[model samples]
Target: MNSIDSVTLEVADPTAAARFYSGAFGLDPSRVRVRSCEAPTTGFRGFTLSLVVSQPGNVDALFAAALDAGATVLKPASKSLWGYGGVVRAPDGTIWQIATSARKDTGPVTRDVDELVLLLGVEDVRASKQFYVEQGLTVGKSFGGKYVEFATAPGTVRLSLYKRRALAKVAGVPADGTGSHRLVLSGATDPFSDPDGFAWEPTAPLTVAN
Candidate 1:
């Protein structure tokens, strides 16, 4: 099955973004990397990087740290019908959502992330779903024509699709965005951009930072 190998965020300051990710989310370069770019972009970027945790406390933990690390709160951490979650925008303008399906903690609270998801907000969920299906991805879940998730290999970022307007609303940002997405997916597929203009590149060799 086709799967994303990693994600790179094009930011203006790679060093600062690296520091923020490290301090806020305990993330390493292998999980999410950063590169320098000043591409023109405004409003919503049409994507969100989500960290799914095990309980509410973890959500709160990361949320507070993100705020302390200079992130702006888009939506305060709170409980919902689906579970507890919150949204924040990193210093580099990348929107992130920290959430958990379990309302209560079953074990000691930790910053351990359960799943890392890269959700692309597409203009047409159905059409984008079909585009990925044709790219060798197997559908894991689908909700009518609103959302679709693709199964990913263990330890890799899971991919999902959501309606552009609904996703922007969920992120608490305006739906209208222009210029570059400022996001890139490194996967096994030959380099290609999706229907919505999200680019995918062939996986590159990993170079662990010192």
Candidate 2:
């Protein structure tokens, strides 16, 4: 089964970026990697990393923690048509959404964040959905021509696609820009980029440092 092993972000300083995420969101420092960029400005345009938690408090606390860690608040937490959620921009300019559903979850507490969903804003949802289906990902739930979500195995991050303009409206960001995404997804055997330029590379084998 295809699973997202890790998501890498490019930043000016890997150590600093790793530290910020680890401290603010409880992400393992090893999971975040950064590289130098010569570009003048870097901002999120087409994708967002979603943190799905089990409880409403989790959403609030995580959102607060992000703000306390020097993250720029894009949207304050509130109940929305989509559920309870808030948006924040990481120090490195990556956009993140922390949210929880109204549905009650009786699952045991495993972690502060229950699951990660990589939501990509694609120019064409239909074409992007077809491309992923051909790459062996099963469709979980798709909405007419507006949205598509992929089924993922337990403990794996799920991938979702939505129209660029729609996603921009949801995230409160502009829909036009051209530059490096500064994000990389790993797990697929063959490296590929979706219609929106989100790159997925094969998961590298873990190494033991003796």
Candidate 3:
């Protein structure tokens, strides 16, 4: 029943990040940022944090918005022979990838639940394990001690976590946003929820649209 609404990347500029994300994810980059920030501050349940900003900057506004709001510029924007992308360091040391495009959208589309996994590195694995146990979850298995996964609910998707070192190894890239942080979700799981916890209940049953 649980689902993902949005996966936020704390960027130097929400607009730039959104633009990069929109072009990359094929979503419309039409955000009402001032409205989004009018609400109360939130914890990890929904979004990681709330961003507050008023207007867009320029044709280069995406970069400007994030920078003005305190996003560090990691890479400058440029038209690569391969693709269009630039990297920026977020306020919290998270690397933000602003790409005009991505390669893979090859899909045999289907109806299912999309599990939004959060990759967190906690100080104590034992304490983290106990916390989830209290939150109505059972730790399933450790992926070679690098990760420990938990189930969302009965027959639900698995939300997994891993140490930074191990995650970097699995991702085959540095733990820097220069690459991209992998929010590893089960490809076999259902696509069910959005960021608001609203059900995106696909009317049709599971069928891969090729």
Worst lDDT run of 10 residues, candidate 3, spans 30-39
Candidate 2 lDDT over 11-53, as tens digits, reads: 7766677667877899743344455555544444688888889
Question: lDDT (0-100) at residue 50 of candidate 2?
Answer: 89
Each candidate structure's TM-score, on Cα atoms with residue i matched to residue i, is 0.96, 0.88, 0.37
Ranked candidates, highest TM-score first: 1, 2, 3
Give the C-alpha miss distance for residue 34 in model 1, angstroms.
0.7
- Candidate 2's C-alpha runs over 4 A off are 29-36, 39-43, 103-111, 205-210
lDDT of each: 0.92, 0.77, 0.37
Backbone clash numbers for all candidates listed: 0, 0, 21
Cα miss at 97, model 3 (Å)? 12
Better of 1 and 2 by TM-score: 1
Cα lDDT tens digits for candidate 3, 1-210: 232223333333445444443332233222111001222222121111112112111113455545665666655655556544445544433344344332333344221113223445443455555655554456777655456776555333335555555444332345433222212122223444322222222223222111
lDDT of 1: 0.92
Best lDDT goes to which candidate? Answer: 1
Native-referenced Cα lDDT, model 3? 0.37
RMSD of 1: 1.4
Give RMSD to native, each candidate. Answer: 1.4, 3.2, 13.3
Better of 2 and 3 by TM-score: 2
